[model samples]
Each structure stands twice: as C-alpha cells, then as structure tokens.
Target: MGLFDRKIPFKYLLMGIIFLIVIVLVLTGIWMSYVNSSDNLRENAYRLRTMTESYIENSFQLIDAGLKLYDTAYNHDMQEAFAVVMAEYNGTGGDPSRMDLEALKTAIGGMDVYVINESCVIEYSTVPADRGLDFAVIYPDFCIYLHEIRNTSGFYPDRVVRDWSTGTLTKYSYMPTSDHHYILELGLQSEYFEGERKQPSYSVIVDEARAFNPYLEEVLLFQKQKRLIGNKTYVPTPEDHAMLDYILWENRTSQEVRDTGQERTVFWEVIDLRDPDYAADMSIFAKLTYNDALLSQELARLGVLHAFAGLLLLFFGALVVIMVSRELSRPIEQLVNDVNSVASGDLDHAIRPVSGYEFSSLAESIQVMVDRLKEQIRKCEINEKRFMDLVQFLPQGVFEADAEGNITYANRAAFDLFGYTQEDLERGMNILEALAPEDHTRAKETFMAVLQGKKTEGSEYSGVKKDGSTFPIIIYNTARMVKDGTITGS
Candidate 1:
C-alpha cells in the first residue's frame, strides 16, 4: 500500500511496481525451468532402464530360439531311429541293435540318449548301465515333462531342469514311435548353450549403453558378492567405488546424484540383472557427471541483463518525470513573478501567453485585472488634478491631511492664505501649527472629529502666519474617500 502513498511521485511508484513485476516474472521462469529439468531427468532415467531391460530380454529370446532349433533337429533324428528300429523288428524279429546309438548321439550333438518301452523302462541306452532300469525312477519330473511335450505336439517345448545327481541343469528332446510303445530321449546340459560359451559378452552391454546414452561417463558391471566384472569410463574418479557401494547397499534402481568435489555433479543408475539360471547375482551401473556451475551460468548472465535493463528504465523514467513536472509548473512560476512586479508599481510588467489551454485562460484573466487597475489609477489622477484647480481659484483656502493628521497636500489658495512658501508645505507642515496657541486645543478637536467621519459647520479660529502675525479665520471640516468608497484621509 505504501507504493500508492501520495508523498511519493506517481511516476516513481509506477516504475517501482513495474520493476517488482519483472523480478517476479523472472523468478517464476527460473522456478518453472528447474521443475521441468527435474522431470526430464526422471523420465530419461526410466527410459534408459527400459532400454537396458529390452536389450537383455531380446538376447535371452535369441538364445532360447537357438536351443529350440537344436531340439527340433534332435527330435527328427530320434524319430528316424524309432522307425528304423520298428522296421528291423518286422523284418528280422529282434530289437533294433544295428542302429549305432553312440554315433547317432554324436551326430545329434548330444551326450546321452535312452530308449524306453511302453512301461517307461529303459530298453537301450548309449550308456549300457542304464539299460533295464526304470527311466521314471531315475528322473520322474523330466520324464513327465518329456511326455507332456510329446503329448502336446510333434515339436517339444520344454524348459531346463536341475539334475540333483550331477548338480547341473539339463534340457531334453524326445520322439515316440507311431504305435506309442517306445520313446527316445536326448539329453544335454543347459550350460552347453547359455553359459560362457554362448552368453553375451560384458563388452556388448557397455557398448550398447554408450551408444544409447552419450551422456554416460562410465559403466560398471559387477557379479554377486561385489565382484567387479567389467567397467568402462570416459573420466575416472576415485569416488566411483564409494558411490557404487552406496547404490548397491540401498538397492535403489532410481538415479542418485553425488558431489564429486571437482565442481561437478555426478548421477548413477543401477540395474539388477537377476536370472534364476546363474548361481550369483549381477548388476549394471551407469555414471554420468557434468559441471553443476554450468547450470547457472546462463541465468547469471540473464540476471545481469535484467539489472542493466532496469537501470535504463529508471534513468529514462526519471528524466521524463523531471521534464513533465517542469512543463506543468512553468506557467504558474511565470505568473507569480509578473504579479510581484505589478505589486511593486510596474504596471507594464504584463503576462505573456502560457502554453496549454488552462494556463492561457489564467494569463488572460490576470491581464484583464492589470488593465482595469491601470484605468482606475488614471481616473483617480484626473479627479485629483481637477479638484486642485477648483481649490486654487476659490476664495477660501483648501488643504488635505492623512488619517494621522499630517498635512499631505495644499492648494495655492491655502499657501497664500497662510502666507507660507511651497517649500514649507512640502516640509510636512501641519495646519495646527498655523493656529494661535490658545486656539490649538479647539482646532485639534475639530480636525480629529471630522477625520473620524463627523461633520462640522464653519468655526471661527484665530490663525497665525509664519511671520508670527495672528488673524481671525473661519475653517470648514469634512472627510473624503477614494474610488471604491474606502476612506483614505480627510
């Protein structure tokens, strides 16, 4: 509310309000920019996470497809073996022993195979010790999964299972005879396809991360128990290990920032690449660092620019206010000086035309007043001269005095009657001096009474000339006033 106080000028108040508005708007823009920057960072973190997940998932799918192709190839080869065994049984009346299971197993890229009868008993196997044994007794779950796939369709779709005896995960492909009396099983360890032999290299992950996000400053890959598997860094720092430790302990997938003591801000994003097949845990982390001071560099420049602009505005605004105030007050100041001059008896000191309609009308009014004053003074002088002539030719003497009873004017007849020179009248002569000493009291009373607006008829008084001669004289007393009817003197 003080902004609107009248003691402060209107232009100054308006400039202050405008400056405050500019400051508010600039601050609001800065706040909104920060908010939007934070939001964009969060979104970028999530999108990077998604991209990494997709890359791993796609790699796993490709490996699984490769395993499925091998399974299909093995299934077809085993079906051919079952058909050969049946044909040999029909022609030679014996089990199909001529079919080399070892060579067939080697050709099918498998380590073992087992042939089982309708009762789920192994009749032939690459390892002879497994013959005459119940296959379901050895690995019932695996046999069940095999039959489930065989029952479903010609192509097998089954996942790997852990073989408790060998401490290894194993995958199997199977085929059955058309009569459904015999089945062939081909077994291979899961590691043969998904272990170090075929898994994606750590370099692939690092390369892909670098390619996807150029902002990445470094990447660290770790196995379970904090074992460092791989790392790639554009700019290595000593604090990286500490930051990674914090991220692992917190188990947070979100991005976190750290102060690197080098006038830079660094952020980290961790991804847990967990898989059931692997015996240990794995993680992927990415680090990105940037100069935090750079964030405010532009804003600092903008602030300086705003300050400069505000200074420019203030300077121009003050200049304009001064000019306008002077323009408005000029005419009034001129009129005041002219009035002072006229009061000092310089009637010719007249007003000139002032700029603007209002000031022009005021100047015209003042000129009219001055003209009327001059005219009245002219008439007063004329009346005084005519009265003086009449008094000079009269038979009696005439004189005038101020309210204080000091003689101000005397006509020629008054001087002649009193026998005083004109010099004596100019030297402040009073009529009381011309009266005889004994008649002074009565004459003084008469003069005072008349000056106070009382009329007096002629009174006989003894008068004395400057030569000390006394004579009998009659005096008439009266009062006079100037124009406008204000009493001046008698």
Candidate 2:
C-alpha cells in the first residue's frame, strides 16, 4: 500500500525491461565485433591491392627502360661502326695489340660499353682479359644472329643471351659485321636496374638463367644467386639455401610472371601485405595492422564497459528489491503482532497504522471492537453484584424456577430455610423434590395453580432439608410475568 506497494510492482517491471535491454546490448556487441573483424580484413585486402599495383607499375617501367636501352644500342649507325672495327681486327688475323684494344675500347666506351668484340670475338673490354674471348663459344645464338646479319644485311635489335664470366648480370647488345663481327655486351649489374627502391617481399627479378630453370628452384636459389653475384664469387651457404627452399615451393602457384627474357621470367606475387609475419616492416601493412589492433582494443574496452554497466545495474536492482520488499511486508507484520497481543489477553494493546490507508482503517476497526467488548464485561459484573445484594434483603425463603420446573436461583434465606446453598438449587432439585411426601402433591397443585396465573393464598406446605430435618410453613405463591404478559418465573 503506500508508494512502496504501488511502485514495487513497477520495479519488477523495470527489471524485466533492463534484462531485455542487456540482451539487446549483448547482441549488438556481437554484431559490432563481427563488423569490425570484417572491416579489418577488407582494409588488409585494400592495402595488399595497392602495394601489388604499385609493384606491377614499377616493374613495367623498369622493363620498358631496359628494352629501350637495348634498342638504342642496336641502332643502324652503331652497327655500321661496330662492323668496321670488327673487319679491321679480323683482317689483322685476330691478334689485337694493347694499343688496338685501347682504341676499340674507346670506341665502345662512347656507348658506356663494358665489352667490345671484333669478328664476333671479344677483342677489347673495360676489363682487360675480356679481350680475345670467343663470343661464339660463349653465346651461340648471338653468334648465329651475327652470321645471319653478315649474309642478309639485317639489323638485329632483340635481347640476346651472353655468358656472365665476369660474375655479373650483363646487358648484351650486338652489331653484326661481314669480316669480323663486333659484339658489344654491356655488363649492367643488377644493382643498376634495381634503382633506389628495395624489392618487396615475394617479388623477384629473373633474367635468362632464372627463366630457363624452374621458378621454384630459382626462388629457392635466389639468396645463393644474390650472394654469388654480390661477392663476384661462389661461396656455398647450405643453411641459407635450405631456409629459402620451403617458401620457394609455396610461391610456385601464387606468383605471376611479369616479363620473360630469353632465359628467365621475372615472377612476383601479390600476397596479403598486412600479414604481420611476412609484411611487418612495410609501412602500409604496419598501418593496417595498427588499425586491426585498435579495433581489437576497442572491442575489449567495450566489453569491459558493458560488464561494468551490467554489474552496476544488477547491484541497483538488488538494492531496490530489498527496500521494496521490506516496505510491502511492514503492514502484514504489524497485523500479526496485534493479533498475538489480543490472544494473550492484552486487549489494551492497539495496532499502530503505517502508510497504507487499508492498514489505518483496520487498526481503527480493531480498537472499536475491543472497546465494545470491555463495556459488555463491565455491565455483566454490575448485574451479578446487584443480584447478590438483593438476596441478602429477602426474609422469606425464595427460590426462582424456570417454566420447566427446574430451580434457577435461590436466595440466602431460601438456602438457610432448606439447609442448602444456591449450588444445591441447580437442575437436580425442584420445590416439589424439597417438599415432604405428604405435601408434595399439594405443593405441585398450588405451584401449577400459581403458574397458571391464579394466586395461591395461605397454602400450607411441609418441606425437608438435605440434613433430613422437616418443617411446616404457610406459603403464598404467585406467578411472575414480563411486561408483555408472558410468565417469566414462579
């Protein structure tokens, strides 16, 4: 009753609402986690795509430049000049002196040359021993092309294979001649083509030697090849080669060939750049990884917040339930205490009203009933004392009888006259029983006459007491009547 009784039900209703809200929050949190994970994966994919596109574009640029440089070096004017130098060296029986070698080297040096040939045989080079090397034995295809140009007089401006005796990647551009074909093979180190930027993970530049062989073996041997070319000598490192072997096989199917040379195909792969184990050092991948890490952190933080909020709500709900339950039970507790007091004969005790209107009304009603019961008990005490005083004043023996001939009341005079107390005048004895046998019949006739509203005057009666003594008396009898003319007693 009070605010507590009315609002306690609402509190339970609110608790049910809060429970539903918490369920919704949990569902939303799960959905958000899924969305965040999907977004992270999508961002990683985007980063990988961007990195791959950049790598491919850069590769195309490098290939175009290299091809253009090859074409420039194989022009007609350059071929004619190389052919003139080759005819002179062959006319001299292939024995080029130091002065002749220097002049030939100077002529090819105009094109930033590394090697020069006379009569399809190397006669001069930036490195001294490169002269007097047979080009046909080192590169049969170039030699065959030179022989074809000598016969048909056509210019060959295509990529050709050449021996890398100098232990470097060499760019060879040939000019054929009739007498002594001059072959200019420029040793362009891989470093020159690599530019300022470093290669990304899973990208490789393969030239002729790598293209002819299986890519799986080449990728496996990449470190070994790098060391061999960098040091300009072969020094086998088995552990390094073994380490490269596992990933090399994994790359065979994933990689795409960018360019094909005479003996090699440059292969590269567009792997997930955001993979931390592989692309940890890349800036783009690092940023993507950071984004995913941030999302994870956010999800964890939200979970903690949700848990804290739920705990707080639960605590508040428990507190509210305790307060509301106590408030609702207070009135019932008061009612029980009041009833116990009344049962123990403490009728003076009264119920104290609390907040509820119903409790107040019940308390008032209980007090009223207790007051009426006390008044009735006081009136009964007064009547009993008055009756005892009246008995002391009566001189004649008087006995009261009900209409059924049972003695109902006996005064002190009557008790002394009959040698009996009021206790002996109970239902077991009547006036007729107290009379002597001879007077019993006369007593009944006179009593009946009086009961029938006829007064009996000077009736003679003899009675006996409980002590076995007998006496004679003259009795006057009359009928007792209520105001409504009904006989009450005789």
Candidate 3:
C-alpha cells in the first residue's frame, strides 16, 4: 500500500545511490587535478628553457662585440708607432747602430724593434738577442720583404704568428728608411693588442646571465673544461677543440634548447675564444639553472582548491540526499500507520492527508475506504443488536469464533454461562479454552470442518468453566465467508 509498507527501508536505497554518485565525482576530481598539475608543469618547463637560452646568447654577444672593438683600435695605433721609429732611423745616417734605439724604444712605450742594414743583416737592435743575425738566414721567407724594401722602398703589412711553445702571440712588421738604406722590424705580443685593456671576466658573465633573466636561479661557469674523450680519458685533440668551438658558435647563433627538469632546469653551452689574440685558447661552459617560482606556487594553490572542492562536493551531496530521502519517505510512512489503524477496527478514526500528489491521493483513497467501512459497520451493529436481543433472552447461549478458534463476539448469555466477563471476551478470549482439556483437539477439528464447508450441525462436548467445573454443552459453528466465498472465520 505504501513505499515502505514492507520490511525494507527505501531511504537506505536512496542513500546508497547517492553514495555511488559521490564516489564517482571524487575520483573524477582527483584525475582532473593531476592532469592540470602535470600540464602546467610541462608548459612552464618549456617556457623557462627558451628564456634561459636567449639570455645567454644576448649576454655573450654584447661581450664579444666589445672585445672586437678594442682589437681593431689597438692594431691601428701600433702601425703609427712603427712608422715613427722608421722615420727617426732614416735621420741617423741609415744606420741603426748609430741611432738612439733604446731611447726610441722607451719613448714608444717599451716595444720590441730591430734594424736591418742594406746587406739584410740585423744591426742595432732593442732586443740584444737579435743584434747580429742575418735576417734572411733566421727567416728564410724574408725574401718577400727584402724584394719589397729593395725595389718599392715601402712598408709591409703586420703578420701575426702564435708561438705555441711559449704561449705568446708575436706580430711582425717591416718598414724601410726614407733613404732606402735599412728595413725596420717590429714585434708585439698578444698583450699589445689592447695594452692592458679590460675584458669581461667569468664573474661578469655570470652576473649578466642573472641580470637579463629574472627567473634564473644560479649560473655555473666552468672555465677551461676539458673535452670528454671515450670513458676514462680527457685528452683534448684538435677535433675535440674544434668541435667545442663549433658548438659554442652554434649556440650563440641558433640558441639550442637543452634538457629540462622539475621546478628548475639546468642549461649548459660551451663558449669558445680560440681566435688569434689569446696566448692560450680555451673554452668555457656556462650552465644556467632557472626556476619558475610563481608557476610552482600556482600549482600548489590548484592542489588546495581541488581538495577543498572535493570535500565540499561530498558534504553537500550527503546533506542533500538525507534531506531528499526524508522528504520522499515521510508521507508514505504516515499513510501506512493510518491504514493499519483502520485495519484494527478503528473505523471512526480520521486519516490525515500527506504531501505530494501520489501520497495525497493514497491518503484520500484510504479515507474514502474508512468512511465506507464505518457505514457498513453501523448497519451491521444494528442488525447484530437485534439478533443479540433475541439471543440474550433465549435459554441457549450464543457466541462467534474466528477461524483460529478465537472468540470475536460473545452474547451476554454466553458470557454468563462461561463465567467470562464482557472485558475478557473483548480481550480476544479463545472459545477453545472454554472446552474441557480433553475436548480441545476435538473442538479444533470441528472448527476446521465448518470452515471447509464440510459440517453444519452442532455437536455435544464437555465444557469447562473458569472455576474448573465441567458441564455438558452443545457447540455450533458456521463458516464466516467474505464476498469472494473465502472462509475467514467460523
């Protein structure tokens, strides 16, 4: 008749369905949270890697351009100083042996110079070791300079040579006197390229790396790092040296991206400075590590928000289920109790209506049935009273028993005969109890026979009173059949 009229509670079923929905939502939230975090991390890693490489390239380019300017300026100044020394030599009778070469060398800033007589022989010299040697014998390739000075009587371009054994760069230049009597030779080392000029140091490069890229954590500069050869050896070959130079050049030009790490990434590249100016050429490795602190913080906040949302979903889902289940079941439960009240013969009891369309309709139907039953019961009571008045005045006692041998109605004369009060009969006193103990089984059989429509005549049996006194009595039973002809009682 009602949703929960049987033993199982419908609210538990509703709660179970809600629990499954909550579990699915929680799992989906967790999955989406991890995916969001991982995607953010990957994107941040890529962005920072590109930023770091660009900063390194820009910084190195600035330093390289500055050094080249210094180199070009120094070369022009040195050629002018050589021209001055040659003009002064032509005034000394075209003989450097008679000239003030020491004063001339000191006045020109203590540079190395030599004088070659017309015989192509080293004569007066600032460097004592080169004083008496034949120029053609020491430098067999001096024929070109000799031919130029002898025929054209002009100066020669500066030649740069790296003395690898001594780790010094020597610049050689030859100039003829005005009278064409001598050739002046000059040599300057790599230091003379800028004459104590300032250059960007490793520390400066490290600072520049950080200055340009704010996300940089630290810069690691490995100077003169040897090339890796096989597994156990670190011997640097020409090819290895050349490869490092190429890598450095490619990095500065193209800016290759490197491997990335979590939270922070380390990027490294070789910086080559193998040009002729250096006494000893070597490469440096610049390792830049970058950190995106803001991105990391954002991911942390995302995690917290994900957790909070999941918890809120669970709490609100449970509350809604509880409220909804109670709302749905409350009216049905009230209808069941009202129906039970009518079943217990409380025909006059009022049936209270409940909420909702279906529940309200069920309550209305129950009330209509109760009102019809009350009318029927009123008519039955009037007929029963008339019957009882005739039976009450008669000498024979009358009673009615149900199918289970429980007395439903006992007339006044029947109650007086059985020594049972009206209250005792109203308390559902069993009619079988009025019979003698030995007659109980026979009485039960007789009741069954009447319910099955097998017997109609009354029988004589020994009846017992409440005081334990026995007497002979005749009991009659007839099936109490409903509209469907089903026997409900006898």
Candidate 4:
C-alpha cells in the first residue's frame, strides 16, 4: 500500500530505486561533513584555549625567576650598572636632599632613577619634577606592582611603554634593597626600545596560534590594566570590558557564542603573585574567538563534490542497467516469439539461436523438437500416399467428403464408378450430386446423420453419373473430425 506498490517493469523500478539511493547518499555525505566540521571546530578551539592559558601561566613563573627572554647581554649590562649605582648611593637611600640628582644620572649611564619608600611614593628622582609622584593615586596597577616588589630582592623588568608625562618610550625596572627600605626604579630611553618593540614577543606567539587552527580568529590577553593585546593593538569595547569584568569577578572560565556563528571564550586563573601578606592575586585572562568562514567553505565544496559524484553514478548506472536488462531478457523474448510462431501451425518455422548458455540450450531443444515432428509428418505422409495408391488399385470405389457431402478426395475406382472425370471431381462434387434425383433427399439425411457421430454401414442407392446416366451403387460413408475439429468424409 505504499506509494511504490503498483506494478512496473523490473528494469525501470531498479533504476529508479538505485538513483534515489544515490541522491540520498550524496545529501547524507554533505550533512555529515557539516556535523563533523562543527565538532572539529569546537575541539580545536578548546585545545587552543587550554594551551594559551597554560603558556601564559608558565611564562609568568619564568618571568618571576628573572627569566629575561628578550635579551641576555643587555639585561646583564643593565643589572651590572644598577648594582654599581646602588653601592655608590647605598647610604643616601636615594635621599633627594643629600645628593645632587644631575651627578647621579651621569654616574648611572644617563638612566633616570626613582627611589620610592614603603608608602610607594617617588620620594627622590634624577628628574626633579618626578619627585613626590604618588603611584597609588596616579597608576594604581603599577603601584600594586611596586608594593609587591618592595618585599623582594630580585630586580624586575617591564616592557617599553610611553611615559604619559614626557611621551617618551621608556623601559623600566625595579629592585628593593636588602633591608626593604626603598624600591629602586630605573628608566631608560634609547633607540633599543624601538627595535625591541618590533621584535618577536609573546603577543606574536599568541597570534601564531592561528596557524595551527583555521577556525581561530584571535587570542587576546588582558594585562593588569585591563588592556587587550594580540597580534596588533586592540581597543577594548564595552562588551570586551564587561566580559573581562564578569570573568574576573567570577574568577572562573566563561564562554559565549554569537548569532553570527562566532564562538568567544575567556579563561581566568587566580595565582599568588608572590607579594607580602599573601593578599594580592594576579589575574591572567585570555579571550579566544572562533569563526566559521572556513567551515562554510568546506561544506560548500563538499556539497558540490557530492552532487557531481551522485550525478555521475546515476548516469553511468542507467547505462549499465539498460545493457544488463537487455542482455538478460532479449534472448527470452526471441524464444517466446519463435514459440508463438510454431504454435500458430508454422512447423517449418526455425528457432533462431540466441546468446547465453541457457538460451542456446532452449533454442536447440526447440529446434530438435521441430525436426522430430517434421520427420513424423514425413513418415505419416508417406504412409498416406501408399494407402491412397493401394485404394486406387482396388476394385471398390472410395471417396472423402465434408459434413455437407462436398467431395474433398476421390480414388480412380470412385471416379470410374461415378462416371465422372477428374476435372468434374476437382471442380465440384457432392454425395447428392452422385445420387439420382429421387435419392438426393435421402443422401443429404444420411450425410448429416453420419456427421452426428452416428455409425454408417453399407447403404444402397442410385448414383448419378456426369454423363446424365444412373447406376446402382453401395456407399460406405463415415464422418470424422481432425485435431482442429474440422469435419471430413471417408
């Protein structure tokens, strides 16, 4: 009762079903590719996100251990100059009132110096105007950093940043004294900062992550100042600020997906920054954005390829079906037609040989049957000819007629007995015609009765001759039927 339940040719039905299957296969392949691509995108994004978080966390630890990755010799030289200056001004504790600031700068390789007390205020500096610069009021993030450094004896280096007041690109470093009395600050402004800024840094490392994953659109790391940096500088939007705030406030990971098929995620961790009171926490948050453009291209390409391949399958499948169906049924059709011809009484009709082992055998068997039948017919015909020759030599007359008493055959004795020439017999003759005018009615009745399956025996009657004469004759007539039910006389 389904839609395809109706009767149809086997060849066409098979072709239809196979073509439909090809179409379904093509579409399913395309759909599966999309699903797999989506899953791969999610997996790849997760790996990159996890790697970024681990790299930054480990990098910070290395940085804490005085791992100056950017420069080796230059960093050692800076440290050496800072040690000499520290010894020269050790007693002063960088007390601005006791030392001449101009002479201090010349002795320290022309580097700016800022000495801060426990209050994290710039109590003295080579630049006099920088005096009394309260870090807590001006730069709270930098102030937090200095407070952490005042408890450590290791020198800490920072990246090149433009000093807001002087608009000079400067590199800064800090060191606390043995007694934790003051935090030493060193600032250098040189052409080296410009080349170093353009060199390969951690920001480039984050951006290069995209090489490993095509779906990765960007990776952004937020500094203590809440500034986002990646390949190039990126200005933070309201959404960016809100997302960072939410992640930091929750102190956990967060993920979001955009309606435009962009997946955005932020990962955060709270690690002890090695500060006194164990009260301060350093927050490192990385934001990763995943895009679907490449996935879109791949899906489209897969669709087109599947479609083309399906079409090819259909086209070539149709050709194969046609050839196979013909090869299967053609020989049988020919055999059927030959059988029909023989059934219609054309015994001489030949059975044409066909291809295939089964068909050839069938044709040979049919041809053999026909030959045997023809041989039987020849023997029968020969026996009948001999019978007719024997009947001709007999002294008794014999003949054959239809149910209507029409003469179909006659022997020599019959022609002679009826006084009719062979021409008269061939033209037209009947039992009634052979009888006298007075016996005609009886002859007709006798012929009909004989045809009705009644037995007929020797009957006396007056037979009329073609010469207009009459004779007394005894007829032995019988009606018979043949295989096709055609009535005849004997």
* Most TM-score-accurate candidate: 4
Model 1, stretches more than 4 Å misplaced?
1-301, 316-355, 437-461, 472-489
Clash totals in order = 0, 7, 0, 0
- For model 3, the superposed segments whose C-alpha errors exceed 4 Å read 1-27, 77-205, 208-215, 222-265, 271-284, 290-305, 308-398, 402-448, 451-476, 480-489
| TM-score for all models, in order of appearance | 0.45, 0.35, 0.52, 0.54
* TM-score leaderboard ranking: 4, 3, 1, 2
lDDT of each: 0.62, 0.53, 0.67, 0.69
Local accuracy of candidate 2 as per-residue lDDT tens digits, 1-490: 6645664544455555565666676557656765676677557644654554455445545643454454355455455555655555566765434235446645654432333354566655656666676747754544555555554333344332223454433344444334334444433233443332223222353233223322223432232122332233555456434433333334322343322223233233322222121101111110001123333455567667656765665666666655765666677668768867876888778766766888778877887887887787678789978977887678987777767667887778888888887566653677777778998777778778888888668877777888978888777777888879988768
Candidate 4, residues 273-346: lDDT per residue as tens digits? 43342222334455666565565666567557756866676677667766767667788779888989998989
Q: Can you write out model 1's per-residue Cα lDDT over 317-341, one digit (the tens) per residue? A: 5566567666666777787788889
Model 1 earns a TM-score of 0.45
The superposed Cα distance between candidate 4 and the true structure at residue 81, in angstroms, equals 5.4
Quick one: ranking by lDDT, best first?
4, 3, 1, 2
**Alpha carbon lDDT of residue 202, candidate 1?**
54
What local lDDT does model 2 show for residue 18? 61
Best by lDDT: 4
Q: List the residue pairs that clash in candidate 3.
A: none
Which candidate do you rate higher for TM-score, 1 or 2? 1
